[model samples]
Target: MLTIEDCIALSGLNEAEIEAISEHEHIPEIVAVEYGNYLMHSPDGVPMLKRIILDDIAAAEQRNDLKHALHLRLVLRHFIRTHRDLHKVAN
Candidate 1:
């Protein structure tokens, strides 16, 4: 059985992205790992994660939480740089 840490390490997603997904989707960290794995493997996963990050950033903005919004934005930017598909989307 794959541990959450194992999955996270293999998924190539940052901790912030995983934490944001887990919190936004109300899922456990392990589940978030599985979701991250799926997204990492799927062709459309990068776009989906991008959309989720945008939503999280929007929510943070709505709450006037500049720190959280900036953090999420940074995560998204990092994801785009690290993942080729997402980099394409960023361009």
Candidate 2:
């Protein structure tokens, strides 16, 4: 059986991005790995993933967790930089 870390490694997403999906979807990290992987391959899923990360950042700020909020912002920045579709959306 594969460990959660193995699943994450094969999911083509970093731990932070997977955690954001888990937070936004109310799913476990392992489940998030599969779900996020599915989303990465779907045309609509990329934008949805971006929105989910943004929502997580907002939630972190709402709870006054500045450190976590900042971390998520960095993850979001990295996410945007890596996803070409997002750049098109931004332009």
lDDT of each: 0.84, 0.89
Model 1, poorest ten-residue lDDT window? Answer: 82-91
Q: Tens-digit lDDT track for model 1 on 1-91? A: 9776777898888788898888789899888878988987777788888888899999999999999999999988888778875657544
Q: Which candidate leads in TM-score? A: 2
Give the count of colliding residue pairs in each prediction.
0, 0
**Distance from true position, residue 56, model 2, in Å?**
0.4
TM accuracy, model 2: 0.87
Q: What is the lDDT of candidate 2?
A: 0.89
The residue ranges of model 1 lying beyond 4 angstroms of the native Cα positions read: 1-3, 85-91
The residue-level lDDT of candidate 1 at 85 comes to 59
> Superposing all C-alpha atoms, what RMSD in Å does each candidate have to the true structure?
2.2, 2.0
Worst 10 residues of 2 by lDDT: 82-91
